[model samples]
Target: MKEKLGVVPFWQGYDRKEVLKIARIAEDLGYESIWIPEAWGYEQFQLLTEIAKETTRIKLATGIANVFSRSAGLLAMSTATLDEISEGRVILGLGTSGKNVVENFHGTPYRKPLTRLRETIGICKTLWRGERLTPEQSTLAELRHFKLAMTPVRADIPIYVASLQPKAVRELGRIADGWVPTFWPYEHFNEGLEWIAEGARDAGRDPSEIELAPFLGVVPIEDVDFARSALKPMISFYIGGMGTYYHDMFCRFGFTENADLVRDLYVAGNKQESIAAVSDDLVDAIAICGSPEHCRERLGEWRANGMGHGLVGLSPGATADSVEFILKAVAPA
Candidate 1:
């Protein structure tokens, strides 16, 4: 399939005015969707609402909002509200965030990610259908016997699940309208797709109906050295220090064999060494960092691997003009 291309805005340093300008420009650029993220600094829903009002046709999505942070019912209400504001162009992306963010930042327990995700999705679907919710003893218990006072403008809002593990990916296929993921290498896409298909069959849902959208880190530059250098910080941060021993994505990717060495280098502030520890093959496999033509080949591989949407995360110092250039160069003609 010829897939849609999208952009993810780094809403951190921008004021409201700047964000609106970016959103408007993205819409004008013929982009299919714009993903807004929530973290400690910014509110995802508020930013999305503003962007929805500013743009005419582009879709708006929460790149991901943590399932543990809010009550499932409240999340459904927020999703419905955003959908109404965007006139049914909202995609609710939900995830079980890592322990560092969920526990330390949000002051919520990070436990039973699979079960929590299942319950949260179930409750959100129920609430979206205008069903009265009575909280059970699952991860979702903050809102009990609550129903939205106002009626939703639409009940067909798409719910995308942000997942990294096989289990969650499969569960997402079973229940979610779409999948959002990170750190997925093009070569391993089928490893995930197979699990997702299993879940879809288990739930009696068509696997093809589930949209697969994965974020790709791209630095479109002819200067290979510069592009490689720019990706170092992110590589070191995620591969070295993003999570605890029990739940690190990097370790699962085989970087754990050098765990102490990697962490020590990262924590002692030798970021370059930490980046060096990340294998060149792994980095090249996962990220699309090269000239425009090279990026097109990489994107083609991802598309062949079952991805339906490319969510590009442009690196720092990468201008919107550069992004637009790359998009036009690689987008299907």
Candidate 2:
């Protein structure tokens, strides 16, 4: 079966107008969804709100809003507000973003990501259902004694969990409306899905009911070396400095033994060495590169692995025109 494809804005330094233009184009091209990520620049909610207004059909999702950065109630409120604005076309993608972002950026300790995610989802669901909430201290306890003063336009907003580890992905299957994993190779998803299915069965829910949304870097260049060059900085950043001991996904990719060495090499300004360290097999597995036809084949692999939503993280140099061209070339009519 042919699968639907979406797009994620890298959100470099584009102004709001440029961002909205991209959104309009994505919508025009029939992209399934448009995701806005939160990190260094503009706030996710604000950008999503603008995109929601600019486009009418495409779904708007927070590629991820870190759970540690906002209180459960506040996060719930944000999701509720966005849902209202978008008229129920919002997918709240939540995550326990690494210790780097949590501690360094949000000034919060990154402890018990699993517990935090569970509580945040529970609280958000309750708020969306218009249940009253009472302030609670524990991560697992439910406080649905207080209700939102304003009525929610729609009570059912999908919540997708952004997880990299196996345990978290399983937890997402148990409770979240969808799964959002990054840098996962299509071939490796079966193992991850097994964990998710286990979680679903434990919760007495069917695993197939939960949505699977995977995002990965896509550089659709004909020249293999040029594509590799374009992807080097991104690979270097994640494999090197995205996290310290606690927050790197490279370890999960079987680089556990050489993670520190890779990080040190990457940090010491040895970018070429760092990229060299990233095995060609690793790059081929996680990223969709090469010609348009090769990218379509990769997309087919992701679909066969049970991904319901495919969010394309377009390369930095891919212009909107180029992106549209690539999407048309790969996506089913």
Candidate 3:
């Protein structure tokens, strides 16, 4: 809840103007960074470019720019350009979006996620270091001889991977500069970190070198019931319709019964029931909601659990004023 917290004002419900307003306010309020997300709405780079021109200080990140959307070399060039334009304030956050988005939306085959991620990172890093792409390292033949025409502001842009599965999380620590975990409850936060550390140690890297930046959903309201209810729909969507990968992860995260129930009800078209089944404890486990005081205490607990930097999502029904209040309440002392 310190200045280590970043703001991820996802552009799902908000318009462009409103998104800019939030970003500007977050920067002014001493937030560490502004993480833009790319699901299906707006392209992350264009929005990031606009934010770069509008703000001078806050660092910019993708929250997660889907790996399936573009080739590794192209991602490298785009990130390099963004870093240059943002004056070296860019963190490349990459994720293998769910099959629904990958196969359906992007029309790309969803196979070899681990290989794709590994190869992408290798290719991007090689290109960023001003080296030509090698055929063996990249799946894209077009990038075989391509070199970035423009010099990048920083050769080493921090790469953060958004992962929840154990194998993916392990690989993240072994190679990525940071991690962006979702639905990561504080109770098992240490357990997740241990997986990452094991991978880091196996790779001969210090575990501390790996940054822990979780994406948390926060709903600030005095009425705990309303706050919990407001968060249920989003939670249901991710756990129910998102995919089996996440459902399995939630099970592993110690929510096996709840996850199974939610999935059953949700898939059976009992949407409201699924939402209703999201227990208060489950909601509280992954998110911070309640009065300002309660939220502060929860964030303190999160900070104590070794939250370094984070990206927080202000839940849907919350006003801009509510977000501002929480911002001040949790700002670094």
lDDT scores in order = 0.76, 0.77, 0.84
Question: Which residue pairs collide in model 2, if any?
Answer: 132-146, 132-147, 133-146
Instruction: In angstroms, give how far residue 72 of model 1 lies from its true place.
Output: 0.8
Query: What CA root-mean-square deviation does each model show from the true structure?
Result: 2.7, 2.6, 1.9
Clashing pairs in 3: none
Over the stretch 1-333, how does candidate 1's per-residue lDDT look in tens digits?
455878776644535565566567667767788888777877989888988878879889888888889877678888999888888898888988888888888898888878888888888777777887764635445656776787787766788898887788889889999888777766777877888899999999999999889887776668866776666667677656766532265566655665556677888898888777665655676677788788777788888888898897755444555556655655553
In model 3, the worst 10-residue window by lDDT is: 314-323
For candidate 2, the per-residue lDDT at 250 reads 57
lDDT of 3 by residue, 99-178 (tens): 88899889999888877898899888888898887677755444557778877888899999998888989998788999
The superposed Cα distance between candidate 3 and the true structure at residue 165, in angstroms, equals 1.1
Residue 317 C-alpha lDDT in model 3: 38
lDDT by residue (1-333, candidate 2, tens digit) is 446677887756545665677778877877788888888678999889988988888888998888888988888788788888988888888988888778987888888888989988877778788876665735454555766777777787888988877788888888988888877767778877888899999999999988888887777768876776666667667767766532256566565655566677888999778766665566677777789788778777778878888888866534666667666666544
Task: Give the best candidate by lDDT.
Answer: 3
Question: Per-candidate TM vs. native?
Answer: 0.89, 0.90, 0.94
TM-score, prediction 2 = 0.90
Judge candidate 2 at residue 189 and give its lDDT. 82
